[model samples]
Target: MAEGGYIDFHVHLPWREHDPREAARRLLAEMDSAGVERAVVIAVEPSLKLFKERVNAETIRKAAADALDYLVYMRIPRLRRILFSPEESLNEHERILVEHTRRSEDVLEAAEASGGRLLAVASYNPELGPIGTLERIKGKRYLGVKLYPTLHFCTPNEKRLRPLLDYMESEGLILIVHTGCDPGIWELPDLCSGARPSSLEPVARRHRDLVIVVAHLGSYSALKPGIYFDEALRLIERYDNVYADTSAVDSFLVELAVERVGYDKLLFGSDYPYVTGLTIADFVESILRMNIEWRAKMAILRWNAERLLKRLGRL
Candidate 1:
């Protein structure tokens, strides 16, 4: 931890059933131990309940629409009351909305109690319709919105997500999107095809003012080598608002990011909890050891993200 302290641009809390307080506490402990000043806790949307293991465009399109419908209906107070009043008795669709909504509230509560140590971000399946989710994010304390097209089953440039991207630009909210492959043992490879970084080119070009983050540096597991790193790098180089973070990757890739993407468009992020091999301190130290200037390291570690957050009035 340098004098400015490290700001983790990418972090996650438990997505499954768990105690919110405990989850927040675990994150804080990691921050304190790693000398992290603040970490953005993202409210994650539940994964898609696809009927087939092999996902097709038509199936994804329908699922995306269904996801949007659920999020939109969730905005109704009576619907929320009715569903949550007997949450234990909810069906699959009802449970997804209830769970995602509750997760958003939980992160907000944790951030409130964090005393400035934890910042919150909200994520939704953009293909599902960003309007409802974007509307849900408006006026909230969350500094940004996260989109996981890979797991949630959609692409960044999907026709349905245009309005949501527009809303984010006007509202001055940052967007941290997962733009790589998911090779988790339990994941469906077919569903992740849409997470490619190049899929975002259309939206990035359309909304030049919107701040976009390509997480994991567009790198993927061994199962999918050379996935979208080139596309992510091109996006960062092509658009001033486009940025990338070093999360769930190795130091070699960080070196490549610094050499190729430069420090201004790069942010430091320890994917946390999910990164079992290294500690936050290890990631920081690796950056320190890079063959780059200290100033560049400082920007990646804190100032770069701080500048973005300050513009959004999140700081």
Candidate 2:
């Protein structure tokens, strides 16, 4: 690891707009400006096969209706209270899934050319089937697999996912699960029900040896902030192997997390490209300006992630 620079625990490559190499270059330039020594670039794979199997015509119709309702609710304050609707519709999610599918190969290729400045974490969708997915990623230098429970329309504890989970545990690969809320179609609570932090408890309990990192600190919701933060704290406090990333969480909440759980289990993450209006430098500066001691700030910014990377033999 570099001597004195931030190790971002979360970031993503630009979607289909840029190819892998150009994406890596842009990401590296951003990191350089932010004083980030390295970053873990997580791939986002919204499988069409999974979407087709899970979503029917009725679901689409309901999504369109809900979307219209959400728009109306946003325009009227009374409707906002009465409906309590989500910001995104199911139809929007379908469009994103179909149009913005990111492959693990793209992420790996980008990181390969990043001169060790980026670490790749592959995305897995169970709809592709475990045997083929595993075979495809076998012997590839991915640090771990990232699972999107809400987007994939499955929970972490599903029996079908056991084979993949078991393989990750046995192979010493970390599991980064998307907790809290997501944007686009998954903004609806019903669609993203599996994203709640509590949903991961069964998996954490069953796989004691597996290292699990909950993304977004269980509070990435744009409409309902910190919705599952307490549950995330519960998992971190109860399970020795469970950790969290502070991506897209409010600064006050980041401070609150330190107060509740300390800095040891919290990793710095910018959720880059997705964090509108703020640069990676802005996220790093926020941590630096916190009221905590320098040691605590450094732990969150660098050392904590460094320790994890070293353990995984990636540093």
Candidate 3:
């Protein structure tokens, strides 16, 4: 790894607002400004096929309102426990719908154009046939697959996802799973349960060969801070292949993770566009300022992720 250069394990192409090619260029500029040598740009697909038939103008309107409320409460932590409450969980007839989908092709195209400054991670919605999804990303240049169990309304250990996990492990690809709560309609209790880090324990136990990076350190939600922080730490401590990322988590949790599992098990991730008001440099600075050894800071900021990418032959 280059001196003073760190890898951002989690970042996203601005598929919602800008063209992926343009978004890639903008991300590179930001990285250059932040001293980020490389980043893993994740593609996301929050849209669900089961809810497609039920989606209409009214549902979309309600979804937008839910998203706005979530954003507001995120900015004001006090409002989370007081004002924010969904009347009902997402059911068959009523559910949140996101029209936009970030395709893996767009992410790959952008990564290909980044001159090795970026690595692509494809997104998978298990509801959309897992085997077919596997076939789609089989020969692609993706470093791994990112799974949003809470957003997709599924669990990591779902039977449908077995084939995909099996294939990734066999091919030496990594698995980045969303192990914390999500905002908007996903904040509901039912959806939140899906993202619990405990649900991933079985998957980790079964697929010991597959490298798993638990995103958000299993405690990213403003509404419920550190909800599954302990569970995430336990996995990292118990499984050699299981690790956690410091994306969208509080600084104290990072300290706690180090105390409990040490620096080698932690990776630095900025969550990028979703981090809001913070640059990749800001995250790097936070780690640098931590009350730990200089070597630990370097491991978290760059070396840890550099080792993973190297194993995958991406470096």
Candidate 1 Cα lDDT to native: 0.71
lDDT of 1 by residue, 1-315 (tens): 567578998877744537777778777887888778988877766544431343433443444354454334344443343333422222433444444443666777778778877888777743345777877877888777888776566678878877777888988877788877653311223446577788888888989889898888778654444467888889899888898888776677777777886889888888765566667777777778887888888998998988887877877
lDDT per residue for candidate 2 within 6-94, as digits (tens), equals 99999998644568999999999999899999999998887777776776546544554665644453543322422334223334456
Q: What is the lDDT of candidate 2?
A: 0.82
Output the TM-score of candidate 3. 0.85
Best-fitting candidate, measured by lDDT?
2
In model 1, which range of ten residues has the least summed lDDT?
A: 81-90
Q: lDDT-based ranking, best first?
A: 2, 3, 1
Lowest-scoring 10 consecutive residues by lDDT in candidate 3? 81-90
Off by over 4 Å in 1: 14-17, 51-102, 125-128, 185-190, 224-226
Best by TM-score: 2
Tell me, what's the RMSD of every candidate?
10.1, 3.9, 5.1
Clashing pairs in 3: none
TM-score of 2: 0.88
Give the per-residue lDDT digits (tens) of candidate 3, residues 261-293: 899979999988776688888888888888888
lDDT of 3 at 91: 37
| Number of backbone collisions per candidate | 1, 0, 0
